[model samples]
Target chain A: MNRAPGLKTYAVIYLLFLYGPILILPLFAFNDASIVAFPLAGFTTKWFAEMWADPNLWKALKNSLIIALSTATLSTVLGIFAARSSVRYKWPGKPVVMGFIMLPLVLPEMIVAMSLLIVLLGIGINLSIFTVIMGHVLMCTPFAVAILTSAFQSLDRSLEEAALDLGESAASTFRLIILPLVMPGILSSFLITFTISIDEFIVANFLGSGQPILSVYIFGQFRFPAKVPSMLALGTILVGVSVVLLAIAEYFRRRGIARTGGKDTGGFL
Target chain B: MTFSPDRPTMIEFRDVHKYYGDYHALRGINGTIRAGEFFSLLGPSGCGKTTLLRTIAGFEGIDNGAVLIDGKDMAKVPANARPTNMVFQSYAIFPHMSVAENVGFGLRRDPRSRTEKAAAVEEALEMVGLKGYGARAAHALSGGQRQRVALARALILKPKVLLLDEPLSALDKKMREHMQVELIKLQRQVGITFILVTHDQEEALVMSDRIAVMFEGQIAQLADPETLYRRPNGRKVADFIGTMNFIPCQILSETGGRIEVEAKGLGRVMLDEDQVPPARGEGEPVVGLRPETLTMLYPGQEPQERAVAGRIDEVIYFGDMTYYDVFIGGTDVEVRLSMRNVPGRPVLDVGTEVQLAWSPSALVLFR
Candidate 1:
C-alpha cells in the first residue's frame, strides 16, 4: 500500500494539537523563568524545589491520594461482583440495573456533584474529604465496571466447571481459576479508577468546599502568577506518573493475555 | 439389545426427563451403560446427547426419573461427589497452570501425600501419551496436547464412569482419528466405563462398543456400531448414522414371521422378521440398503447370487472407491452402488449401462 503524505501530515498535526500543551508544561517547568512563553530561559530545578516546599500542596496531595485509593478500592470491589454476575448469570431486570449502575458515567459530573451535595446536606452530613471520596467513587465506578466486564467476558465458563469437576469447591475454584484469570482486569480497573478520581475537579470542588483536595487546591493556586511555574513542575510530575501507571497497567493486561493464550483484543494503551 | 446380568451395569437412566424453561431437552431417557464398556450417545446438535452425558456427570439435574451410578441414586449427590469425571469439549486445560498442576487438580482433596499425587499425575500423563509434558505450561501446548492433558486430568481421579463431551471435536481430522484409536486403547487399558457424547457418527462408531442414537431428546436406537449401521430401527435413525438409500417399497404379502416387499428400484424380495423392524408409524414401508451393500458389477465380473440391470445416472470418483448413481430396472429411483478402484478397472462414466449385485438379507424395511 502506498502511503499518503497528506494523511501522514494530518495525523502529525492532530497529535501535536492533542499533546502540545502537555509538551509545553515540562518545558516551562524546567525553564528558569516564571513566564510560560517562548525565547527559552536557562535551566533550573528551583521550581521543583519550591513545589516540594509548599505544605498546602503536600496536604492537598495527601487528600487526593486518600480519595483516589479509597475510590479505586471501593469501585473495583463493586465492579468485580457486578462484572462476574453480569457475565455468569441471568437475573431479572439485569440490563436496567446495570444501566443504572453505569448512569454516573454519562450523567454530568457537575450535576452529580450538585445533587450529592444537596442530598448529603439534607441528611445533615458535613462537607469533608469523606464526601469528596464518595463523589469520586460514584464517578469512577462505571469505568471500573467497563474494564472488569471485558475481562470477565473473555473468561471461559468451562474453566470454572473443570475446576469443580476436578474436586474443587466453588470458593476454591474461584481462588484457583477465576480470580487469577481475571487479575489483569481487576488491576486495569483499579489503575483507571484511581487516575480518574485523582484528576476529577467538579466532584472535589462541590463536595470538599474549603478542604485541601489537589484539583481544588490547584485551581486556587492559579490565582497567584508566581506559583504557576511550580504548578507546571507539579503538572510535569503528574504527567510522568500517569504515563508510568498506564504503562504498568498495559503491561499487566498484555501479560495476562499472553499467559492465557488468548487473542490480543486491543486495550486502552 | 438389553444388557444381560453377566455384565454389571455402571450407569442406568430410568425415565430421565429434563426441560429448559419451555424447551424439552431430554424426554424419558432410559438406558443402561455396562461396566468397562465404551458407550457413546450419538446425535445431532440440540439432540440432548451432551445433556444426557452431563446428567451422568451430575452437572445437569433431571426433572423426573433417576440416574443410578453403581445402583446408587444420584439425586442428592453433587457433581464433585459423583463417581464420574468429564473431559470437556473445550478440553478446559487451565491456561494459567502447568500441565502437571492441571492433572493434579483433582487430587487436591485426596488424602495422599505430595509425592504419591505427583506420581499419579505422572502415570495419568503417561496413560494419555503426554509423558514428561507436566512441566510445560498448558497455554503453550497445541490443541491435541491440551486434549491429552484433559484426558489425563479426568482419568487421574479414576472415577467409575468417565464422561467425554465431544473431547476430540476440537482436533483436526487426522488428529481426531488418531485420538479415537488412542482413546479406545486407553479405555481398555484402564478398564473404566467411558461414556462419550458426540455429533460425529464415525467417531462414535470408531470408539464405542455400544452406541445410543438420540434424536429430539429421545434415544431412537441403542446398539453396537455394526448393528446400527446394518439395521437401524427407523428411517430417522438410519438417516443419521450413515448413508442409507431408501427405495419406496410395497408390502406384497405377510407370512409366518416373513414379509415379502416389492421395492421400486429392485424386484420383489422376501424379508425375514429380523430384517424388518417393528413398524413405528402408519406409512408406506421403504427398503433401506447401505451404499456399500449395493455393488457395481464390472466387466468380466459375475454376481454369483443375484444381479439387477442398471444405467449409470452419475459417477462420483473417490480416490479409493467410485460411487455410481444407477437407475435400476427403468425406475426413476437411483440406487447408489460403490465399486473399489483396482488395477485394470476403469471409472464408469454417466449413462453407462451396468449390473449391480446385492443381497436380500442386507435390506432393512422401515414403515
Candidate 2:
C-alpha cells in the first residue's frame, strides 16, 4: 500500500516494454491491411485462414510435435532417476557430476548446437528429427531434474518406509506411494520441457538439416514480405496455446499439492 | 518382580551388537520379551533404544548375534515378511488415501473376500474408537486421530509383536496421558506382545510391565517398574530414572549379605545385599535414597524410625506437593524431601528447623 509512485510507474513501463511486441502480434493478425503500421486497420480473418491452409506449415508442425513429445518423455523419465538419487543419497563428487548435467541450462545454445553438429558429422550420423530430439532432450533434462528434485525432497521418507513395513515390496512401494506423490512434479517437468523443445530454434536449425521443423520453417517464411501477416497470426495462436498449456500445468501442480496436503510455494504459473 | 513360568518368551536377543562406523551401538544386548507383555526400552537420545526395537521388527540388522521371534531365528527374514508391525512416531498416515484405505493398507495382500476385509477394517476402526470415520480423508484428521488410525493399521495385521517408537511423544500432555491408558487397554484386548521405546521415565513407569534401561548403547538394567525406580542398578540408572540424593559414605564392615556404611548426613546404616547395587568406581562409597523415602516431621510428631536433624534451606511448592531442600546438621550436603500438601498442614519456610525421618532398608549403597 505504501509503494512509491516513481517505482510504481517504472514497474508499469517495464511490463509494457516486455509485452509490447507480443500485444502487437494479435493486433496485426486480425488487421484488414497487410501493412503492420498503425492507423486503425479494420479487423479481418484472412491471415488466420492463410496460415491454416499452408501444407508445409502443417508438416513442420507435425515434426515439431513429434520432437517435443519424445523429448519431454525421455528427459522426464531420466530426470526421475537423477532427481531421486540427488535428493536421497550422498555420493563422492556428486557436485561435479550434477554440474555437468546442468551445464546445458546456462551454456550458450549456439555453442552447444555447433559442438553437437560437429560431433554428429564426425561420427558419420545423418541429422534428422531424431537428431533434433536428442538436442532438445539434452537441453530440457536439466530443467526436468531441477523440478523433480524439489518434488522428491518435499516427500516424507517415512511414507515409503511405512509402505514397505506394511508388507509391500520396495518396487510396489515406489509404484504405489512414491509415484503418486511425485506425479505432479513429473507433469510440470514434462510440460515445461515440451514448451522449451517446441520453440527451440538454434538446435533445430543446426541439427535438423533439411527436415521441416516449425521454428526453421517459420524463420524461412519471414524471408517473403507477403507472409508476414500470416506469421503474426501463427504467433498469436502459439501465444494462446502456451498460455493455456501453462494454466493446465499449474492446475495439476496445485491439485497435486492439495492431494498431498502440502503448502503451495510459488509454482510456474 | 515375579513373572509366571508358563508364559513363553516371545522374542530374544542373544549377545546382539551393532556398530555404525566407529561408534558402537547396541553393545552385546541380551534380554527376553515375554509373550503378551508390555515391554519398554527407556533411554536418553542416541542410546540405541530405537535401534534395538527396530532390530526386532527386522528394520535393522545386528553386526553380531541373532534376534529370535517366537523361538525362531529371524536373521534371514526381511521386514515385510517379519511377524512384527510398528506404529511410527509420526503416525505416517498415507496422505493421499481415505482413513479406511490407510487402515486397511496392510490387508491388501489378504486372500479374504472383499466383504470380510471390509468388515475387518471396520472392526479395526471401531477398536481404536474411530467408528464411522472410515470415509474421512486421512490428511484431515487431528494428531490424536492420526495416531489411532496408525494403531488400527498396525493392529489390523495381528502381528506377533506390536512395536511403538515413541508414538505418544507428539501429543500434548493431556492427550498423551489419555492415550497412555488407551494403549494399555488396547494391548490387553489384543493380547499381543507390545514393545515401546520412549525417553520419558514417567511414561515408561506408567505403561511398561518390564522396562530395559539402556545407557550408551547397553542395557544397564531390566526390571519391573517399581524395582527399577526403587533399586536402580547403577548411579547413572538411578539418576536418569528419578531424583536421588547421594550421600558419600565409608564402608565400615561387611557380613553375610549385609554391609554397614557410615553415611555423611544420615549417619551409620546396615544395608542388605538386595539394598546395595554393585559397587562401581573407586575412592569413597556412596548410598542413594529417593526423595519420597525421606520425610520431615511437623511439630509434636514422634519419629517412627530413626531421625536426623536438619534445617530447610529452600522450598519448591507445587499445587498438591511441596519439595524442601534440607541441610542436615554437621554436614555440607543437602537432601530434598517431597511432602504432599494436606488441608490442615502448613508449608514450611526456608531456614526452618525440622527432623527428617528415614528407614535403613530404603538406602541403596553404591560403592
Stretches of candidate 1 off by over 4 Å are B1-5, B298-302
lDDT of 1 by residue, B195-301 (tens): 99999999988888899999999999999988899888889988988888999999999999899999997889999998888856937789999999888777768
What is the DockQ for all candidates, taken in turn? 0.80, 0.74
Interface RMSD of each: 0.9, 0.9
**Among all candidates shown, the one with the greatest DockQ:** 1
Q: Candidate 2: misplaced stretches above 4 Å?
A: A3-7, A90-96, B1-6, B282-284
Clash pairs detected, candidate 1: none
How well does each candidate superpose onto the true structure, as a TM-score? 0.97, 0.96
Give a tens-digit lDDT track for model 1, residues A143-184: 989999999988888888888888888889999999999998
Grade the docking of candidate 2.
medium
- Which model scores highest in lDDT? 2
Q: Give me the displacement of residue B91 in model 2, in angstroms.
A: 0.9
- Residues A88-133, candidate 2: write the lDDT tens digits: 8889999999999999999999999999999999999999999999
Output DockQ, candidate 2. Answer: 0.74
